[model samples]
Target chain A: MNKTGKKIFINGNEAIAEAAIIAGCRFYAGYPITPQNQIPEYMSWRMPEAGGVFIQAESELAAINMVFGASLTGTRAMTSSSSPGISLKQEGISYMAGCELPGVIVNMQRGGPGLGNIQGSQADYFQATKGGGHGDYRMPVLAPSTIPEAIEHVMTAFDLADMYRTPVMLLSDGILGQMMEAVEFPVYKSKKKLPEKDWILDGAKNRKPRSVFSLMMQNPTILEKHNYKLAEKYKKMETEVIHETYLAEDAEILVCAYGIMGRICRGAIDMARKEGVKAGLFRPVTVWPFASEVVSKLGKKAKKVLVVELNLGQMVEDIRLAVEDNKKISFFGKPGGAVATKEEIFAKIKELIK
Target chain B: MKAVYTKPISLTETANSYCPGCGHGLVHRLVAEVIDELGVRERTIGIAPVGCAVFAYDYFNFDVTEAPHGRPPAVATAIKRCLPDRIVFTYQGDGDLASIGTNEIIHAANRGENITVIFINNAVYGMTGGQMAPTTLEGMKTTTTTKGRDVKVAGHPLRVSELLSSIEGAVYIERVTVIDPANVIKAKKAIKKAFQNQIDKKGFSFVEVLSPCPINWGLKPLDALKFIKEKMMEYFKLGVIKDSTNSKESK
Candidate 1:
């Protein structure tokens, strides 16, 4: 709980804004988009009070670039948007990651292949985990099943981003962004000292000016070297993988889910156990790197593994790779902005038994 | 005798990579001299555009970052807002600012962000091998406009300074060229005025410099200067289009 007595009943978007404030994020720029609009709405008023800067940018394109600019000045900056808006931001996001600038990007996902309704979906999993933009790079994608977890992820995102010198994503969906819950935000502090950003463009007061650019296309060798450096960073991120397991030590069936779907799976797993079925939940907290080691270990023992999601089986592919011939994988999804209820999922698990 | 011509301390020894007779070198020098004169090099943060000046940061002796094509103005807005005490400016080309990044430039100017835009309108995308730009003239031919720019096929060349000057948030807007020595001095003066406006917190200030690209235009160095004076200047008028602060002070 926040010792400052700052606990409040709020939605995920509002909680994200309050968490950003506590994490020392001093700049925000974003465009208006559904499900995520509350973030910009909340930040618009709260940021100025906290002596920070906020801009309702003309478009998501400009908003990401503005955050990129603020990040280069060695300040904590962030931007939030839905699926379509995140697509428009890919170019700037790619540029930021290429330049190795630290920033936080919140993608409160809405259903999409193209303008797919304003309902929650996990279709953007591959987009976030695998390079969302044109790049040979990756960023830590943190998915939270609850509002408190979302707040916690936002705080951790900044520290990891600054530590890794890459952008970090707080991946959520409309289901979480729109739901109000009683939440207590813990004051966040970096446990370790980060290297001073001598590369930031804060003007050359006592030293020569620093320049950060992404256009290394002129020389093939330069871009190759840059890619090689990014690979090294990605390797370092493997040590920080995190996941959660609920009664997977001895189970016949295991459920793999992320984001809000993971929370839904908890009850479904309990329902399965009540019906004399030994089922468990393996939820990924860091979607990238994906805690594959745990999934691999658990997959070897399980009789059946069901990957549940709100999208059309995107993360199922990762689970398949993690389990790779050790066990056969099955998928259950309610795509097109539809969510599966606990009883509905439990029935699906019953069908898998026979 | 004191040296009358010395390299600006704000300009680096990095040999400019611009083709011979390109105006970017001259414009970059003028911006550096202005920064030197204003004594803001130490506190100046520059946003580089994606055109030929993509490496504009390499040539300057101050802190600089590259923004995706046409997003420098937005970048400058955030940088300037985050550190109000520092001086921020964006250097962009015609294609980057006028075409792809039109909305960003307009909204930033409309918000009256206290920053400067050094818009280089060379009438073509020089870095991308002389493609027809938004500012490419009606009859000008390029790789994309192979048959010359047909107004019906494409559109009228954009007059960026004239367009931006109409916005209330734009405090100072001027269109100047750096073709000749006399006009080069005028261009420098316009740049200084734009930066000075920021120092005075006079909201958005813009300088649209009609620079020349000889290699791209397939013209000789001197003839390129003539092209700007004769053809480009006709559609794009020069001189100050807006001086909101200057007008207010006079009243």
Candidate 2:
């Protein structure tokens, strides 16, 4: 166990890979894609040393399916890619969701409508939060604002995946994936024992035969029953939604943001506070199963709410749903590789507060 | 006391959904029999592909995972890697393996993934109506290739067993047909040998079963079998294309 708590300069992608290793990830299959290539590179070297398996699959489609296979065998598995690659992974992601397989998927989002840019972008908000894959399934999505949060979120992702028996996506942008920051590695504790493999198809040697399948057979009634089970699991996950509020109490204006955009919004909020505006910021850590109830509580005290995001008003829709028709909610955003800077967000906050 | 020959242990009691005379039912029974004879019914993991065999997970009493379209190779690769001691195999159709999933199968075999692939080459895509598949014969007509697969437009039919056998990583590659009782026996032997090669950890093993899709072929069950034997076998010869059992690498 690396108990020595030493501060090390690391990027968000590296932090996520190291944390995944600490969380007992024994299988990683991924392809090289911009902004998130560091993740696959790190895993390729680290997995071998940890006595884990690493495969550079032919494509994102193959990579994610490989993770699905490894996860089926009771191993902690993961894959990472940018937006286009993530799109390619959607089919496998849906399969993983259907099979209730546990694994981690990292999406270092770049601008996209079709291979948009290599720069930072949050255009995948709708795809990630609303379930990009086919079918009526939702993966728990985590948005990290800082390098440390990226590490912590990934560790939490593995636990949540195992707990719910579902895939979890860590949605970050190119900026977060590329920027370096001082981070302290989490204390590593080896699990006392590996989880029991009774459900896995390791081998039926001494036990009753086991099977892992997602098909409910073309029977509508059986499919409905299966879907009902999935819905029940999702309803239970509502309690796990997380968010953070800064000076939201006694504020007349509230700013809703997440991921890197949320971090920039904080700066805008600080600028507003110096200008005598009673403004606060609310950042959601878990985007899916959106922290609606938390935001609604904060909305009760605020006169108005403003959402700042990289995409053209994606998260704003969620914010609007959170506040309902009780308060006026406005959005400020830029799409296709344009990031919402502090100046732009501050300008929006000024207009909302005035 | 009277002795009875029951269905293979690996197969469930549920009746098969395959059309009467469909080779899938016969091949399934043969595979189940192999699993029973080898005493590996309990230690096997079958990956069912997206096609007519998508419901294969239900037919096999052992552990199974239904892979997405053309992704059975990738699924089987991962399963075998994670559980090397377990018998892992993928059952896929022409569209699943030769078309959408070509890269996955090729790469897995290139890496010498110790898994068996039961490639069902029925000439045309059976699940989604009579569409021309990667293995659809030249000059053969189907919904997608209504003008009879022109060699200039559609190119030649893919000989997967012969193609895979050329790869150094593949240890066993054979093409067989389930047309008659004798050929069915040979096909079963080929399937069992592919599984046995994996058990021996020789390398990647593939057995392409030339099957019949009667409805898609616009023929009766008997006519389809005859077409597979006389017509399809001319393009996809039935024999062992490659076998590493004689290679010094095995020793």
Candidate 3:
């Protein structure tokens, strides 16, 4: 059913699929994996009714490739998977990057290194922001703290992908993917003109046949030139979409986090403020072009910086890089698949303040 | 007199990256000639596989996407479905199609995707330094099979043509070789038929060519040709395996 202009209770995974459909994503191919299967489950039924195509591919590798194929033809395409399956998708993702095809990929992350527990964990933070695949390419990575925000990111991820002509990842963890929340289609579908997808391979028509590929292997000169061009594209993205701040103004202690941890930290900041301690929050909306400027500016008054996350502080390094020697940095984390409660974060804030 | 036989309009003027005596160049020429003859160059998209022929896009002057090893069929399936009015095909090697990507090929064929598949079977992994491929002949020596492929340990070479022909969606299946001029014509004819099937909106069509790699096969160009004629052909027999769209055959 097309749930446009309707509010319904949906999980994070289903929210993402509905957003993709509203965003004009008519093609989806994915193999089922833990914590992210609801996305494929939802799209399998929704896509056909929406006059689109859906394929339950044989493997994650094949699914990503199918997405590549659909995207190559200038169709809005997408795929979703979990940690292990995302690892398998790296090859096809790299190829798609090399070819510069625009598409959306959702990673409802779970614990990893290999078939780790299915519980929600933010363990793939490094893999999502840093290059999960090979090469010097970066995709715009969106992390949503709630099901509604995940829906918003899905709606925009496709536009960002086509805007930059690159893949955009809607990165969430199992917690957000599994939890149910009331979500509304935030924005009405737009009638904006998309950039000329003149490079798509739909039978060159009257124009010269254009080849979309990433193999500059035969000539170092061409390959080097291509890399430089991609670097310039990435540089243009640094100013695109950055972060969100909560009560960041005039605070002595600033906490930096993202996704579920950021949501938890927001609750803790309220608790700490009620206890007469000055605390603020910096949440990075995009992991690649991280909110470095916001962190640097927000940490100007705070005497101490606290970084909270799951899986042994993966995002702390980004925070450290942003604030560098200007403030004392403290860290807290759970190993994997363990959620940090609001009370635990508030206690950490109290100890750091003390 | 100047020659009238210049390169086909579909072939680019750039030099091909294929090594000397590699059968890929002939196959590329055959595909290009077929596209020119069919007057479908404007609407045809070719998928280059991951192997020595990975650089096939440089030679073919058409829209081409480079697929990961053994994944061209699945990629082609999506492209053809999204743009069914356009002509799409995948050119893949033996190790690419028969081994790592075997499942994708089977499923795409089973689904009856309206696309063309050009499979090149040379029995050894050419660019990867003569590795023992899934189609490596029994008792054949390769880098991984230094002692020659022992059937007791290594599995038998795949008869992909015979195997894929059994699938219901595969409308046409043939195996041809390009060791000689006469055989080259036959290979071109098979490729032409495969493309024609897609043009007719028939289901999946496949043609496997017994190509040769002189450098990897440890033979001179002529000897490579002779090897395909004598040794490779004996194991991978050349013929039509299926034609479901033929007037003689029922659905």
Candidate 4:
């Protein structure tokens, strides 16, 4: 409780860690990687101080799996990594989704097809939003455009994970991770102590023995039952999808974006508005379990939808699906290390309007 | 009136899910007896591996968490750190411990995490139908090693306990086989000592128990035990490779 209404100047990584602690995260396992190394460093020291567990796993694969183990015990757990390391964690993330374990994964994205760079890039948009691992499962992904949003999303990520009993991702980039910002800490609550062994594998002494497993035995009907249960959980998540629209009521061209690009798109929309052009912005806060209805309702009024992103057009696919080909849509993006600047986005909007 | 020998104290009354003569049941019982004897049952947390023993959570009488393949050590590391006063251990099969989970186990040992690792080395993958495993012996037949593990291609079997003993962080490392009554006694002693080391906060302690997988080995129950003694032991030698107690006494 510092001055400025519980406000503190902190970096993005520290904010993420602080948010996790406030959310009652008792376990953190991660490997060191640039841009997001502060996350593991903060947890390594803070978790121990808070009577939580912190482990610097040997690799990203082990780190994510460690989170899987702790989460299975009905504990709030998380791991953070960059692009290449996040790629290693995909298998475990996929398994967590399959098993319906509640956990959070933070991707402080860097450039990559492979070991691309330690610098910031949104190249992982497709990997974060779409199911990166080998499965038909969807991880609810939150893209944070600002440091405050990064902290807010970290808190929301835990609620969403527990709400749906699934893994959630906080998709950020190096700039946001390393940047410092003024943030107010959330009120901390000591987690209500639940029976540790209620559903966990603490030897079968006090209650009926339990198991946390993802393998559906070779029985097809049982597998189908588990899949059906998962489908029902996903259906409940649809009601929680969220987004924001700015000046879209009379716009003829809609600019759809998310994460950092969404922030830049808002700037572009402002520039277009000054020129007396009817341009509006749709910023999706939740990338997966997407805000499709909002996009469709806005699509009805706009003549053309221009999707802008820092990746090679990943969110554009979701926009297309939401609009359902009913509106003319085109995508303008910069892949690899290039970012979509406000001027570049404004040019794209002008082109689309013509 | 005489008391009958029944399921051990740390184990629940649940019937085992293991195949007949599988070594997991024996090892689980042995671990349970040790926990009960040590009076740490209430404070112990067990980590189950991904294999036939994955459901160990159902039979073991303690709080347990099932880990993904080869991740028990990492999970155990967290639990022990969070609850330092609690006794935490991970029970894993050969494939889950020695293969994909190699890095997790080695790093945990090297970091000297205060936990016990009960490794069941049954030579073959029992759950997924007798696949070739990292511990599968040379000249032995498995579904994946139909031609008898070709050393040139697959490499020789790994001796995990001996390998782990070399790490300075490991406080205790022992390998014991449970094929016969005598060997079962030795295996129990080894497991008990491993747990005792953790109770003493000695650092990482590992007990690799040589188990039998009758279903995967294509042999009868007795024959599987015989195979473990006659064939598997030749590749995986049994003995204590490290004891930090001796080092502590010397100091």
Candidate 5:
């Protein structure tokens, strides 16, 4: 039994798996993919111990579909994969979104576009925040900068998914997935407090039979109405935007990033501050319902805003959209799994201040 | 006032969208009847496929969820795994089962998923207007195969029942048709047994019903039945392909 605030040395992938188990995830289906394979490996043994079900699906497609099925039963279901595998799962994810089935999908992203590399990259930022699947849909994406934060984010993702009756994503990366860190696991939450899933299909029983589907071909009007309803839900979800600002209250240079890049920027900003440069970090934890208001407000106060990422300027586009003033924002990116070092980022901040 | 020919309570009052003379309605009735007979209607969950039976959730008066195109088996596998005590089944068409969803079905059977599969093999892509299915008969004419399905190009019609029976995890596999009253009875029996095997905790029961598609086959309703008897049945034999239920009956 995991006690409250039990600290342990754990890898990111295993931490995520254990965190999900603590979050009341009773069913998990996943296919083996790089960087995220430890998640399934850990789940295979731990799930059985927790009296949960674990399936090594034939493909990422099957794994996601299995999660979809499990989700319909009102079980806390999840699936994790790297970039390529996550691409294959988009079909089922789209279906789940259309059906309003709630589940958590973890994308321990590696280099992408197509089987790019087994190294950490934030190239999937656009894919994760935008509708990766084919639909007018948005999923809440939580990007954790550290292992301990990843645990809390995983729990938050499940709660958000169930609260909104929608799919939520815990967006991690290969570096975070492979690294080990000291983490304090929160106590397992009892499922009793979770919102009742009155719409779930555990057989009709005494109630009227229910159907879950996305095919509105029979009536286009029905689909149109559903689309507008989803838009309203997304508008409501925009309020859940979360972010963190480090020493930005009095800074001329605001370095904006997320996930591992956020942690790196914090280090770089500190290095600049030590050397008499007014630099700070702005990290959006929920990248989808982005902390645009905070970024917009902070960007106005700062003389220059620099966006850094593992990919070639993905989230920078969102920052640009948020900060609006094209002249005030700049981007420094390392494409194709190459990570930015603290010195490299500090140099960019120094140049921006000058 | 004997209740002899009353509609099965498991079926809803929704008017089926299936074409006149289509076997789906009959098979639906049979499945509903089996659920009623087994007294599992309250605990039965159906996974509907994306083809003609996409609206099965509306027809079946029990909880039903739609699976993506050709993914009913995979969906059913998860549902059964999550709720072991609840009866779970998937209804899929020839194109959905034999073509796109082959991987899911094969693996589900191999894993011995305790669920039932009702495979309606109409031998052509009926919903999409008479396209060539993997189970489309050799030299058969359809919209995609205007020159008749070339076995050299399109491959032979898949014998799903025979293929699934070869797997050790599959406890029961049968192929039956609903061309006439006798064959319809046999198909019903096969479907019932498939559900019963699931109820008895036997693993991976499958029943492949060789059905008729009058509109897709470009034949009259009566002629479509004749076509099944004369052409379809000869290619896909009617019998229990495998039965390990009795060999290891322990529910």
Candidate 6:
């Protein structure tokens, strides 16, 4: 193992790929998609050196299914894609979720409801947080605002996936995925003792045969029982929900955002503070199983809330649901690849404070 | 009294959900028997496709995972890659292989993934009630291709074995039928050879079985067998489509 703790200059995609390799991801299958192409390109040669398997899958559909097969064998498998590509991957993701298999999916968000531009956008907030695929299921969606957080989230995503025996999504956008930064990739060590994968399909050998499948068509009651079992697992996963607060201890105007928007809001918050406005930021690190309670508490303390995103008010709805009281809540969005500047967010914060 | 024949140890006591004269049951038994004969039952993994054989995991008393419709090849590719020592194979029907899963099957064959594929070609979507498959015979009457499958519109039946045989990565490819006792025996031999090729690490091996879906074809079980022997075999010729393994042995 290369035990170097030295910081390396890297982009978000390479950082995530290297971090995944270091986090013990041994199987990667993905197709080339813009904004996240560097991930598959980096894994191509790096995976072979790390004694892992990497295949440039034929399509996004095939890539996710390949990850499914590898994960069934209890190997740390992952696939990465951009917006439209991720839409193609939903079927396999649903299967992995239904089968209760452990795998990591990284979606470097690009603008889309269709084949949208390759530029960075957060329009996929609804797709990522809500059930993007068919079925009543949820994946722990981790949103990292910076390169370092991207690395940490990749590792955490793997750990969470294995712990819960469920697929996890590390949601990043094109801005963070393409931005260059100096990040010191940490050596990952699991804090909790992850459960042994007693149900993996590594051949029958000395035990009764095991099957990993979700086709419960024989009985509706059986399928309902399985859904309840998954519900219980999701309830247990609530304890793992994470968020970050920046200068929100005594702020009256709360700026709520996530992913790159969160980082942008932080800069805006600092500027707002310098201008004598008590503006703060609330960022949910994990979008699904969201930071509802914390946001609600913060909303009660703050006189008003300003939700900012690079999309047309996706996460703002979640904030509204969390902060259920009729506080003066406002939203500022830049939909479809329109990059939001820190000055723009600061301006929005100024309006909210007024 | 010595036992002349018995069920393969790899098969479970769970009764199959196949139709009265479906070829899946017979083919499943052949595969299980081959796994037993090769002594790889304990170290074998099967990928079941979405079709009538969706419950194959229950029938095969070994580690099995169900892949989405027409994606067993992709799934088996990863399983074999992850655990190369374990024998991995996929069982697919016409709709699952020749139609919806065409890309996956083609790519897997092209990559020469060290896996076995049991391609059962009944020429119709048996599970979904006799829709026109990619391999549906020209002029054959399917629910989707009512009156008859128009050659101009529906196109010709896909000879997947012949198509895959042309790929350099595919080391072995054979097309056989299970319409009669003699043909059944030949089909088993082909299936066994496919598994043996994987055991020897001879790249990709495929066996396409001309199966009988009696209910879907709207025929009696006996007539279904006769149909495969008489009409299906005329278009999908039986026998080895490609065998680079034999040439390698000669060399």
TM-score of each: 0.98, 0.94, 0.94, 0.92, 0.98, 0.98
- lDDT string for model 1 (B78-174, tens) is 8998888899999999999999999999999999999999999999999989999999999899999998999999999998888888898999999
What is candidate 6's lDDT per residue for A1-354, written digit by digit as tens?
233679889999999999999899999999998999999999999998999999999999999999999999999999999999999899999999999999999999998779889999898888888989999998899999999999988999999999999999999999998999987878788767899999999889999999989989988999999999999999988889889999998989999989998998999899989988998889999999798999999998899899988888989998899888655789899887877889998887777656
Cα lDDT tens digits, model 3, B133-219, are 999999989999998999889989999989998898899999999988889999999999999888888879999999989888889
lDDT of 2: 0.87
Candidate 1: misplaced stretches above 4 Å?
A1-6, B247-251
Clashing pairs in 3: none
Model 1's CAPRI class is high
Predicted structure 1: lDDT: 0.91
**Per model, how much of the real contact set is kept?**
0.88, 0.62, 0.79, 0.53, 0.89, 0.86
Question: How big is the positional error of residue A129 in model 4, measured in Å on the Cα after superposition?
Answer: 2.9
Q: Which stretches of candidate 2 lie over 4 Å from their true place?
A: A1-4, A188-198, B1-6, B248-251
Predictions ranked by lDDT, top down? 6, 5, 1, 3, 2, 4
Per-model DockQ: 0.88, 0.64, 0.78, 0.50, 0.90, 0.89
Please name the candidate that would achieve the greatest DockQ relative to the true structure. Answer: 5
Q: lDDT for every model? A: 0.91, 0.87, 0.88, 0.84, 0.92, 0.92
**Per-residue alpha-carbon lDDT of model 6 for B1-251, expressed as tens digits?**
99988999999999999999999999999999999999999999999999999999999999999998889989999999999999999999989999889999999999989899999999999889999998888889999999888989878999999999889889899999998889999999999999999988888999999999999899999999999988999999999999997654311
Give the docking tier of candidate 4.
medium
lDDT of 3 by residue, A1-354 (tens): 234577888888888898899788989999988899999999989999999999998889889999999999999999999989998888888887788999899998898779998988888888888978899888889998988788777877887888878988888888998999987776635433458887898776778878878988756999999989989999987776658888889778898889999999999999999998989999998988887877887776688899888788888998888888534889988876889998999999899877
Lowest lDDT 10-residue stretch of candidate 6 chain B: B242-251
Candidate 5 error regions (>4 Å):
A1-5, A188-194, B249-251
True contacts kept of 5: 0.89
Residues B203-236 of candidate 2 have per-residue lDDT tens digits of: 7889999999998988999999889878999999
Put down candidate 4 lDDT per residue, A1-354, tens digits, no spaces.
Answer: 222267789999899998898778889999999989999999999998887888888999989988887776567899999999999999889888887788999999988788888777888878887789987788888888888788777878887887777899999888788889888876654322223323544344555545566777758898788888888878877776778888988879999988878888999999999999899989988888798988988876789999887767778888888888744988887776667789998998888877
For model 2, what share of native contacts is present? 0.62
